[model samples]
Target chain A: MGYKSKLSWADVTPKAAYLNRRQIMAGAAGLGLGTIAGPVAAEVPLDREPNTLEQITSYNNYYEFGVQKEDPARYAHRLTTDPWSVVIDGMVDKPGTYDLADLLDGMDIEERIYRFRCVEAWSMVIPWNGFELAQLLTKVGVQPSAKYVAFETALRPDEMPGLRSPVLDWPYVEGLRLDEAMHPLTMIATGIYGESLLGQNGAPLRLVVPWKYGFKSIKSIERITLTDEEPPTSWNKANRREYGFYSNVNPNVDHPRWSQASERVIGAGFFAPRIDTLMFNGYADEVAGLYTGMDLAKFY
Target chain B: MALKDTINGWARKLPTWPVYALGALPPFWYLYLGFTGGLGVEPISELEHRLGLLGLQFLIAGLTITPLRNWTGVNLIRFRRAIGLLAFYYISMHLLAWLVLDIRDPARIWADILKRPYITIGMLGFLTLVPLAATSNKASIRKLGARWRQVHWLVYAAVPLGAVHFVMLRKGWQFEPLIYLGIVLGLLAVRLLRKATRMRPHRA
Candidate 1:
């Protein structure tokens, strides 16, 4: 495999409607069992791996909008992503604000079906369309002194009600070590499910570090700063005991509140077995070498 | 007064079946929604949360029967068994949803119950309901007699503990869970006021 693998566009399409029709037909044949038994009968018929677009789009935790899992889908329509521009500053030689159009001028968007694990112990397999973040960083010409890459989301208080309360420090920020930032797996995604990303799913542009927790993928990025000092991340700043900067997916290192050993696969049925969480979210083959000598438990 | 009379009339004639059937509606609705994918993404989580909330609501509703009778002379005592049984069913399903769907691993399930304060409280509340559910039958009521009345008082502890579990489960200060806590406290307050009045010496 190369830096990223591309899945066919047709592969991501959801069969929700078709599945529902089959269930309805089955329920009609079993009318003697009554409506009570209809739903249980429906769930037993099919087995499909990919999450439906509805599942990917509706279930999100963009704390900018609200904390409820469904809040982003309900409220993110108000966010304005059209006239978006990302400021690339700090130690980079080409430090300037570039519009989304200029940023994507010559970039090739590849379809990546990645396993997205949330620190909350849930996961989704998403088909994301984007290019390697290292490509963009290279174009900007990183200075020798830069050792970390800091990111900031757009600060829109009126559009984002969650900002009204100090749930977290406003304008969420995250950072990656220089080598991690330059890793080939690191991507700045613009779309998902072969379509332009919905406002809730970090429209316009967002970071996607697949091996890290979902929170590290910081949404609707407005600033990209290359710095030497470690940046204060939103969650790490909120609760150091629970969240860490690295936030890598490690089953061995449990979250103080909950076990990280296993995760609920989203779109899997109620009785579907929870699978063991993989080291580095199944990307250990590609990323484990990056942290050779360091203790992951301490970092995590 | 007329509305109260009408409710009491229906409560006397039909009693258990109608109210018991009311409890069945939510699961059926949830099942239909589940099959149709009406429950938003992450249907299992949504279903679990909804079922848990339904259990708490019915438990609270069963608690309201005594207070309603004391205040308005509109007794729903006859239907209390149906409501309590429904609460038990929903709560059992809620716990199963978390065990079977959300957490999945049996080892971690024990760890979560022991370690997490919210999960501990929720499980304790579930355990408290066990004896009450076991003795919900007429046979147990006849055998235990006055002791049954004392044991069933566990609802007072179980309902509030369930509410506190909900408040603790969600992150940060959310008003929805707090509102649920407020409702439970308000019901308890009403009961306490009645108990105080009943204890005072009555003038002949």
Candidate 2:
């Protein structure tokens, strides 16, 4: 063999600094930095400060655990995360159940600091550690006929107490257009701030389409089906008027109950003024192309 | 009967002013919670929600006064005014919290009140309570005489509207808000049932 060097990038640069650089680069790339940064430059940079882990783990809207914000934090510890498997089926070349570890094996996990916006007008800056969802789709081989990617959360009534309640019809389902699903920005987060994801924060594996509302980022994914037609999402199915299939964070299109113009930043303290919600949650340059010429107001 | 008599006797001895003083403490406690970070990440929203829910509880409690006397022989009639005023006080504070803490912008506040149906219904409920609160004094009660009872009938409308506001505020069909609405409706239905039964003998 030719003279091989054992030193890796991590060996040369400090691990923390290397990780920080990668995170900054990933965040900048996601924000479409340099091209059209002028609009967002004026507003408070959303993804600069990641929310505290306590705030992230404590406050969640995982209805499978419960409807109350604290319910998931209180009850999600009961979720058995190990021995997890995800079923990848529908329109794909290789369709079968795969072990979580086996599926994620050899995939490069990166730190991505993203602005997580909820349809309910609350937001959080989350530093997620995961690989691009495109990698998984590519490995599985998406068929040309596939138009939508439908995802399903695990339903364990014995473990998940909120399943007992008829809250949004259990096994919280979410979907994205195949193009949107295949976007480089679309991530399958397994950890938050370098730690394994808490059960409340969608342990094992969860989608993180930062541009879309938080609900679209389905948690504890058990099944992922690539379909020709648009798949039904939980909130969209619950109320078509309020939640749309393409729940992109559009400030102009208001949810019937609440204004989308502004969002309350979590961990920003009680008295902090509400920040103006960004178009596509400040990732417009990357994803806004997907919704070009489509009537967002009508769709929303 | 002995237990009911004992309860009513205790109610008679209980001072109404203490209800006002004690009822006023919760909002301050909630403020303390907000300041101390006990209200979680979104403290302003939490504080606003807590105050609104407390106000709704007081409204529901006020509705139960007549029924408690009718069904259980426990007369809380002397405390009705105190309960009603407390409900108004809590609701006003709730509105104030939303105005001051949650949405400080004047134009946006006005826009929400006008544009949003839930806010409109909630505002109407608050307006309904205004006359009831203003006319709660002995002077107005004596001056309005029989009309005071009619003015206070607005509470019947106001309480239901409060429940409806709660129902509409939620994202989807939440059981908690529906349960509140159910209780209010059940209480109103009880009053209607009592009136119908009482009037049947008059018809006979």
Candidate 3:
């Protein structure tokens, strides 16, 4: 009831306003948040299957809902994610804003099984429905000078109560380096839990920068700006010491407050001490080469 | 002899068990809600809000005890341990809610703490209360003696920080958390002023 009016949930159904339940849950591919259903299998290895929005949203991470063991399931319904748009601007050769409809037109989306790790030390393998970020950026014709991509949300202080606070730069700006932008794992998602994304989960469009912590996958994207110099991201500007732009998930790289050496699987319940975290969140082999020369310790 | 015997027996029979049970309600509500499928909805914002508010309520209650005792002759001393422990319990629940219900990525969790100061502070507030609760019992308090007071002093630092954590975690300074902060500050001021005044010895 408290955060209801403020940060209700992602208003994702705008485009899906006319769609059915089955249609709403459809991701880039037809995969939903619960691609396979029933609390993601525990023993499944990282490469076993693709993670879709069904699995991703089915498994959640919106703390604004509340910081509880099952707050997402408890408070997810309060969101109304519809009537959304993306403003494409900044360093791009061919840049033009697009309504949520236009943005969803071109690509054939697919389901990718991604291992999600929070900076807080918990993990879930979600089947996400989205196309690669590179696919869309390519269409928009990002310029060569574009070294980093920054995203922003609409500062709906009247609506998003979270924005009413001085937490992170309001509008929630998040950025990624160009190379990271082009990576195969990066995506822009619209649905989860096998349904159009709930309002709390970043409805219309959200960046899914897997392999890194979840925040890198900025949600409810309203603005896209490419900058030569590093843009001040929401987290970095709010707390410089804690949140650096390159927040890759390395177990060895401890957070200033707690150790990242371990994690607990979402839905696994309490009494489960955090499981040992893997390098690159178990995606190091796939994405580690991206940072070959750069010091992970420093970047982290 | 009759008065002394009867007074001792009545004091022993005073309402302690039920007050303790009343103190356990919030945690029990959370468990009941989860089991009864109260949290079966798609997104979990509502559950989180309730738990967080509940945590704040418990914290406020915990901190309110000393002042309540000072202000009113209400001997809530027996329930103080339960209230203080519940604060920790609710915060842990609030934190777990974020961990399990919200973020499902280990890497993401790391990123949140490192990138988000509010989360870091919130987590610190949670962690500091652990030992305090663990030592709340008579046995641990007796064991730690003066050190128990030192560690428990963290509650003073924690309650406000928890509010700060709540305030900072919000994208904006919504009124509810601010009110929570305001209330906690008021209670803390009373206690601090009391302690300061008591320590001011006969100067003039």
Candidate 4:
């Protein structure tokens, strides 16, 4: 109920917090974002509220429990998200073990409805509510030496039934170039659909790199290591040909096994099997700037 | 008598080469279509459906060879190899479609297999073929000797699994799966008939 200054467009504009999400959804009305239509544009909160959004809840990446898609949703319920701590170290100016509460304190969370594309060429539209990674790194004062920001998930082979497999280096790590980390599209998600994230959906915290394949957004972290060299992620070490460190989305570069030109939108069901993949998952306007003059086919 | 012997010579070789090529065509076509994107408009689901159907077709083809050899003087005994290979090939593609396209995530791929009974059984069916394909070679067959048949007995297990993979993938007892189940049952019945007749003989 406080009077605010003139923040243009979505900021101080008269609309409710569905905010940029409705804008994206409206644009999605035309594109193949799957059965969603955005509400009318407004300077104020629109009368038509955002649809009851959903998260792309998934099985935990732990393979030991059995690599079933539904297993994580069932087993992840046992994971403890409370009293979490992330050790930030390496090239950062400020390195410390910060509690979850302190790290997330006073942060603004926004809902970004994006098409979650898997390397296997399946996808979903998830309404993720998170603060940008740039916001958090700024608090810790990211150093000039920090060229890449890497995240590590907690690994306990004993408890996490999935971690029992050596298929991936447990305590999975994912990284982003400094520019990619600060990109508005890069998020440290804590919630979805305006509700707190479920345990299966990387509760407590997880990264959301919209342009990169889903694996790059590592989940269930224990640490953040900002490094000068590109970090060795679990997937890259596992298969050099299939997974690469810079896994930018490019339709031209077909994943040796499958083509990336399209993706099956999971919830879309039998009648409608898939949706056409977009450039940077349809966040082209926001993220296209980062890649500038670079040829995507070569980098991809 | 000279003409009869000449015709018999050509007839014996006929079933081996051409029928083998025919059975192989389906899987080769599937691979070509998939890689080239000919499976079309509904690529993922369509490819999945076609791959599963092709697997069932090859299963039927392997089964049909017996009938062909039995009914026609053109015994297609050698073509059985190609039929079995194609069966394995189609099933392999089916697994790939599910693993890469259907599930998508490393996390979810494993989850789909472990969590879903249909997928788990289908995965088992697909994996069971690996040893069979490896043993299909004369080297392994000779190496394994008497145990080759026992190891290949896993095909019996694979047959049911392939059916189950199809049944559950489609969900419900639809006509397509039911038709496949019917063919598989008929094929198994023929094999059982031959086994029973063998066991019953010696009175003559």
Candidate 2, lDDT over the whole model: 0.85
Put down candidate 2 lDDT per residue, A82-191, tens digits, no spaces: 99999999999999999998899878897777889999899987778898899999999999999999999999989999887785977789999999999888999999
Task: Give per-residue CA lDDT, model 1, range A81-181, as digits (tens).
Answer: 99999999999999999999998887888887777899988887777889889999999999999999999999998898778766788889999999999
Q: Which candidate is the best by DockQ?
A: 2
Winner on lDDT between 1 and 3 is 1
lDDT, candidate 4, B82-195, per-residue tens? 778877877777677766555445654664557667778877887888898888888998999999989987877788778867766541134457678777877788788888
lDDT for B79 in candidate 3 is: 64
Candidate 3 has an lDDT of 0.66
What TM value does the first chain of each candidate achieve? 0.87, 0.86, 0.77, 0.80
- Fnat for each model: 0.43, 0.48, 0.04, 0.00
lDDT of 4 by residue, A1-300 (tens): 111111112322223544344334434433532333112111111111233232155423334243545567778767777878999998777799999998888778776655566776766555677888888898888888879988898776665776664556667788888999987678898887667877667777989886778878887778998889888887777777667787877666766445576565443322232345667765566677888998776666
Off by over 4 Å in 1: A3-50, A164-166, B1-14, B67-74, B100-105, B189-204
Lowest-lDDT window of 10 residues in candidate 3 chain B?
Answer: B35-44
**What docking tier does model 4 reach?**
incorrect
Which candidate number has the best lDDT?
Answer: 2
How do these models rank on lDDT, best leading?
2, 1, 4, 3
lDDT per residue (tens digit) for residues A29-85 in model 3: 124233442232233334422233333455555544443334554655555556667
lDDT of model 1 at residue B167?
A: 89
Whole-model lDDT values for every prediction: 0.82, 0.85, 0.66, 0.66
Task: Compute the lDDT of residue B46 as modeled in candidate 4.
Answer: 62
Instruction: Name the regions of candidate 4 deviating beyond 4 angstroms.
Output: A1-55, A58-65, B1-204
